[model samples]
Every structure is written in C-alpha cells, then in structure tokens.
Target: MRKIERSRMMPIALYRYNLALPLAPFQWNMSQNHDFIQSAQRTISLERDSVDALLPRIGADFTLACELLLNCKGRVVVVGMGKSGHIGRKIAATLASTGTPSFFVHPAEASHGDMGMITKDDLVLALSNSGSTAEIVTLLPLIKRLGITLVSMTGNPESPLAKAAAVNLDASVEHEACSLNLAPTSSTTVSLVLGDALAIALLEARGFTAEDFAFSHPGGALGRRLLLKVENVMHVGEELPQVSPGTSLSGALLEMTRKGLGMTIILGDDGRLAGVFTDGDLRRTLDKGLDVRQVTIDQVMTVHGKTVRPDMLAAEALKIMDDHKINVLVVVDGNDRPVGVLHVHDLTRAGVI
Candidate 1:
C-alpha cells in the first residue's frame, strides 16, 4: 500500500466513500445547500424592492391616518388577524413607547366579546394585506356601529376593510417575496416599515424628549443615566471625606482612607470648601520633602477643585469627571459647602457610567 499525504488528498473520495451514511434520506449534499441560499437571497431582494415601492405611496391618506391617531383623545386600538396580527402587536408597542397610547386586539378575540375594549373615542387601526381577512371584516360593522374612527392599512385600496375606514393608507407591494408568491413576506415587511414611519412621525410631532422616554424606561441604562441625580448616588455625612484647613496632613489622609475615596475636602474656618487634598497632591508634597506630621492640609491642597451641585444629574457629573480626567467630584451647596462626595465607582455601581 502506498501512503497518501493529507494535503494532496481529494475530499471527493472521502465524501463519496468514508462519509457516506447508511441512511440515504439523511445524506449530506452541497447542491441543495447552494439552492437554499440562492432562494433566500432572492426572497430578501424582492422584499427590499417591495419596501422601496412603498416610499412613493405616502401621501394625503397617510397624513390623514397620522392626524387621526395623533388627535385621538383615547388610545389607538390596533386590530388584525393572523400574520398581520403579529405585526400589529409590535406596532402597538412602538406607538405606546414613543408617546402615543396604543395596544393590540386580535380580530378573533374581538369577535368573542373583546369588542367591548373598543370605544367611540378609540381609533381602530386595522391591518390586512388582502384587505378582506374574514375575521377582521367581521368586526368592521361593529367598529363603525360603535362610532369608532377606523383607519385601515391594506394592499388593495378597494378592499372592504379599506372602504369602511375613515382613512385608507395604501401598504401595497408589487409582489410577494416567496418563490411561490403565496406567503406574506414582502407585504408584511411593507406594513411593518409603514408602521415604524407612522410611529416616528408622531413621536417627533409630539415633542417627545429624552426625559419623557426615560420615564417610560426607568429600568434601562439610558433611563438610569438620565433620571438619576447626584443626590441619589453621592456619599453623604460620614461617608464624605472632609478635613478642616488647619487639620494635619496625616488627619486628612486618615479621612481619605476611612472613606476610601482617595481624597478629602478641605474646609475653611467658615465651614465652606477651601480646597481639596488628593493622593496626587500628597505625592507632590512628599517629593518636595515636606514632613507629613508637621504640614497642614491647606499647605498642599488644590484650591477651587471641580465640584457639582447635589441636584445635578449623575450623567452630568460623569461628563465633568471624564472631561477633567479625574475620578471624583464634591457635591456642594449654593454656599460652596461640601454636602456629598461622588466617585467614579459610585457612578459605576449606579449603572450611570
């Protein structure tokens, strides 16, 4: 037998012989994988084109729908069936988070007494690519009978659902991305993108600010940074490292060590902030051959150190420390009296850094 080098061997022989399995139906092949990839890319391209086609369709009717939802005194009730219902739930969430009050109600559920959720003040935003989903259409009469304002998003303008709506915004697409042209691929993408467009437009029009967004997302990092104040995270009372200007350098060092803040606030005779003595300042004093026992903190302290107000936001405090290349800040009152101490570690612990 002759020895064959691994690098010179052909994978075809291995695949044809050693890799062959007893289960014929579960055999691995490359040709089917290539075809699958090609089909997926073609579907994606078709869907992208479908979304592009929707851009030019935004006009008077789109404006009317937005105006209806914006001026609506009550919530915007999103209703749909099947695949459209899945998109409806996401749309409702986006609308609610971005300043508009909205929620989803399945058409089937609505038919089963969930119709009571809809009121005259509520705006019914219905979705159906076919424009005539049976369950959704079943609710149209009752929606109108309740005197609720209806806005229908459908591919066909002449759809019964569209005709019943006070405003019909066309979400039509050129074709389905599915190879068989049967699945709701491109059509659903168009609907979702249109829903996003509506949500952002309303968000901008309502003058929604970051603070308002923070109120709704209090548990998120952005909310913590924006809503948390200096007073909420600062070290107060005994936790604050402080020393009078006349205190010995050793006493100041003890205060810094006790509080574990690496610095101590130096107060003047009037009990207002006179300066700050930090580890860096101590190093310089030691380099100059100053005796720690004989020196007072005022002799080595840096005057007018960076400070923040107790009411200032923790985010602002972080920015101040970052810009100054420092790790700590003293929270002072209007009279320049030290009230609290904020360190980089505090900001990190509070999830603001």
Candidate 2:
C-alpha cells in the first residue's frame, strides 16, 4: 500500500510540472501581431497598384480585343498555362454566362487531340505571364493554320505569343505581392480584373439585361426573382377565397380559414373587387369591441387594398408588401376584378422570399 501511494504521487507531481510549462512561444507578441497585419496590408496594396497600372494599358488594343470577341461567329476559346490557366477558366465562365460564348482549353492539351476543339470560326484568347510558354508558342502555328483569330493577354508584349496574336492586352506588373517577388500574385489579380472589365464591356455592348442573366443562371435565387410572374405562383379560380361585401365578418372569417391564406376578398354586387378583409382587420375590429357576428365585412374591410397585375414580377409584389407592411396581395384584372390571391407564405414556398 505504501509503494502504490508513492507511485501515484510521483505521477501527479510530473503532471503538475508539465502543466506549469510556459506557453509564451505559442502566444503572439505585440510586435509579431503587428507584422502579421502589415503583411496582409502590404499584399493588398501591391495588388491594388498592379491593377491601377493596367488602366493605362487599356487603349486601342483593348478595343480591338473586344471587337474581335463581339464579332466572332463561334465561341471564344481561352487557353493558358499554370496560374494563368485557372484565371482563364474563370474568365471563360464569366464570359459564357454574360452572353459571350466561351470555354477554356489547356495549352498542353490543345497540342494533344484537344486541338480539334478549335474551329476556324472561333477566336482564341491565350494567357501567359511570360508570353513565351512553350506549349502556347508551339500551337501558334496550328492556330494560324486553322485561320482562327488570336488574342493574347500577356505581361511581355514582345514575346512570341503576343507577337503572333492579332491584338495583345498588356497584363504586366512591376512587382509581385509575394515577399520573394517571384510568385504570380499581382500578375494574376491584374489578369482577373482585366477579364472582368472585358466581360462587363461586352455585356453592356450587347445590351444584356437582368432577364438575360437570369436565363443563364436559372438555378439561382436571382433567376427566380426575375423570371417568375405573379400569375405563376398566385392562387386562382376556385382556390381564391372570396365573399360578397354583405357577408358577415364571421362568414368572412370562415372563408379565410377554409382557404388557409389568412385573408378573404370581398366582391361588390357587380362582381368586382370591392375590398379586402384580412386577419389584421379582424384584430382592429376586435380592438374596437365590434361584434364579428353582427358587423358586415364591408364595414371593416380595407377598400381597394394593394393589388398587383398578373403580369407583374413576383419580386415587385414582394416590394409592395414590404413597403406597406402587409403580408398578402390581391391579383386583379384591368377592370379591378379579383382574379387571384397571393400570400407571403406562397412567396416563401416559391423561394421568391
């Protein structure tokens, strides 16, 4: 028993010594923290300067490049190597989605059987920081043989690729954001920004609108907001909860409950929209000590409440609801007849919310 107690105490003493060890090496000092922040800020500043330098280079060459792309009958074929390849893929995707047909073809793979993807009608956009990538330079002959138009984005304007291209947009940077000044940091950022500028320019030139963009991104929320109309999601025909203006408030409540839309439309004798009786109106009536069984719906109903046209975008209807602090809207025809009812819950279910 004495030996066991001594062994346990020995382990406990070792554990306490280990726990007491200083963690200062792992903790950042004020000077080290300042260095970290300065490193990030320096990278941002260098990249910003690189992009600013590109502004002056956007001259006749830039205009010619856009013209080539705008007039191309076939898709824009983008080619690049290394980091430029990644940027090329992104640029191609942006162009394709913005009404410019484009796709990325790896320079190395193009020399393989993938060169078949290029056609005489297509315009080739090549990216290389050094502008002399062996794979790209080797394909220049074949590109020319195909009679395809070539545009190049490169740092060295005098390099083989740039000299071969119909127009070269300079993407040079004085220094890289990397501490060693060797990584493709600033250069890649300039290329990306230049690509975005090209895409936006082409978009505006082609008169691309939000509706056109929605067609390209049909799976996203923006597409739903822009493409879906009021008639598409509204409750119409028999699903519409409505009663005559002479309906008792209690009868209107029954209709609202049966329709499960939290509101009921009150039509006039001429069968047009006279007013709307909603849950809020019921609350206001009760607050005034009015009897639901005795009061008529027209006495409490809101006259000519917010209405939307069947052709209006659901997003517009959502805005009206938000501005008025209401949750429902009545869809009406030109004659002010209630044709359908729209509830906020319906919009939420349709993902317009």
On lDDT, the candidate that comes out on top is 2
Q: Put down candidate 1 lDDT per residue, 1-353, tens digits, no spaces.
A: 33444344555444444344234576565564467777889999999999888888898988989999999999999988888999999999999988999999989989999998887899999999989999999998888788999999999999999999999989988889987888888999999999999999999999999888888789999999889999999999888888887899988999989889999998888989899988889899999999999999888899969999999999999999999998889889999989998999999999997
Instruction: Give residue 223's error in model 2 in angstroms.
Output: 1.7
- Give the root-mean-square deviation of each candidate in angstroms: 9.1, 8.6
lDDT of 2 at 300: 94
At residue 77, give the lDDT of candidate 1.
96
- C-alpha lDDT of all candidate models, in order: 0.90, 0.93
Residue 110 shift from truth in candidate 1, angstroms? 0.8
> Against the true structure, candidate 1 has what lDDT?
0.90
Task: Give the per-residue lDDT of model 2 (tens digit) for 1-353.
Answer: 12223345365544445444334566544563467878999999999999999998899999999999999999999999999999999999999999999999999998888999989999999999999999999999999988999999999999999999999999999999999999899999999999999999999999999999999998899999999999999999889999997889999999999999999998889989899989999899999999999999999999979999999999999999999999999999999999999998888998999
Kindly give the stretch of ten consecutive residues in candidate 2 with the minimal lDDT sum.
Answer: 1-10
lDDT of 2: 0.93
